[model samples]
Target: MSTKRRIATLIASTALLVGGTVTMGAGTAAADPNFTFKYSGTTSNGSFTVAVYNNGTYAGLAEWNADPVSGHPGDAMRAGDVLSDGWYVKAILLSPYRLATTQGHPATYLTPWKTGDLPEGQKVEMRVAISNGTTTYLSQYYTGHA
Candidate 1:
């Protein structure tokens, strides 16, 4: 292939890869029974809610932001609220090889969660990553649902 053609091909390939990654982490519910799901949010001392809907053709997340920012709903966690905490997303599960973090992401809280098009009807699994602003630690994963 020519230089220009090669560059174009590489760009297209890179775009495809990046696009694939984002879609995989999306919060939207899928028809695939084995598809995984992910969720994220930014909160302070307040708590948030995660509502799951798997009925008919309408299946996705319906999160209610906490007080001072309540009375609204969104598809993405918190929709677009840039709270004190940066962002804490659901964690992965049961991988032999894994990566760890010592200095946690800038967040008021963390949920080391079980995700991936989360299995229908199964309790969502998660862990708490307590951070002292600079350092962090992980907790054992627990099973729960919306």
Candidate 2:
């Protein structure tokens, strides 16, 4: 009711709001450290490589490919194959599907992979599946930590 009392109440409310926001932000940042997914190289005879990192440390690696089968135009890779590295074929996002003959070439997809939490400063290796057309294969090395 009094002007001085009203000013004090407003200041207290502002302080509480700012303090709560800062606390919430700090908690969230501490709970989730930044992680990254970095991949490179193309399928060589069907194999490819990918890497995962947590806070700039090596988290995991996956190298995989589809094996070429005799007589068949495509490798053994499929749309749902899961490798030991917790990576799997998400979907055939884009390809030369409309062209009947170009189907044997490599296709690209926005692959999605999921894994459990990684302990700080630790890493693990695992196999991942890559596809060339309809064929899929496993990576050669392991590299992920949890």
Candidate 3:
């Protein structure tokens, strides 16, 4: 193709790509009773982050009017079980695993999730799991994107 033609083609391709990402984001996972998540996808990119909040109520973060859950036992957030209790995000989709653990209890933290090559709107399904050494609490499976 000629130089001018090539440039025009490139511009058209770019527009389509940007538009596609927005369209793909339309299917962003619905809010789960567990926690809240958000993702805006882009071509040729991967990984995303989600902030987990503990709404002090039975409904968890899903409840808008709930109070902030307090008491970060041990005063720190942890992935696996430790001396005390904390909170973490568990990917319950394909291979279940723990993502980055952020602040817990009285505070909210963001978790960085890897969704390798999230070019075509990758979907992330996970739940906020919390434990207090005695009982483990969970939010609904929050669906988000990357």
Candidate 4:
């Protein structure tokens, strides 16, 4: 086939693939709450970090708010402050053998809780990694029980 015809065929094929994906609901994957738990907080422009805690102990940082509801957690932002936000997360319930003692303690995720949706018997803390350009801010952990 001619060069022009070849180009046209490739473009048409690409469009068809994309359109099929949309028709299958590829864009609505985030709307499902069954995939993760939700948290709430705020931050400034730049990259923010989230760490998990359990019973006043640090578990790790690999699984805290990794997948955000709208975007991946710690996604880049414009240069400025931001409003408090909510985060959807999934709990690491633990593997076989060891009992799941990490329940109800926010699962030691990086993202903070919402303005008024934290669970009881849990203590959440956040440290703003201050920088010359980027800044971080989070709401106080709204413990369910004082």
The best candidate by lDDT is 2
Q: lDDT of model 1 at residue 140? A: 33
Error of 2 at 85 (Å): 16
* Candidate 2 backbone clash number: 22
Q: Which lDDT value does model 4 have at 73?
A: 34
Which candidate's TM-score is highest? Answer: 3
Please give, for residues 9-95, the per-residue lDDT of candidate 1 as tens digits. 553465566552112223333333222223344344222343222222222222322232343322112211112333233322222
Candidate 2 lDDT tens digits, 57-100: 55344333333345422222223222233223222111111101
User: Per-residue CA lDDT of candidate 3, range 1-146, in tens?
Assistant: 86434533553465566552101112122322233333222123222222333332221121110111353221112222221224333323322233434335333433333323332344444444343332333333444433
The C-alpha TM-scores of every prediction are 0.23, 0.26, 0.31, 0.17
What are the lDDT scores of the predictions, listed in order? Answer: 0.30, 0.32, 0.31, 0.25
What TM-score quantifies how close candidate 3 is to the native fold?
A: 0.31
Which rank order by TM-score, best down to worst? 3, 2, 1, 4
Name the candidate, 2 or 4, with the larger lDDT value. Answer: 2
Which residue pairs in candidate 4 collide? 37-89, 39-87, 40-113, 50-110, 51-110, 52-108, 53-108
Off by over 4 Å in 2: 1-31, 68-146
TM-score of 2: 0.26
Model 3: CA > 4 A from native: 1-98, 102-115
Weakest ten-residue segment in model 1 by summed lDDT: 73-82
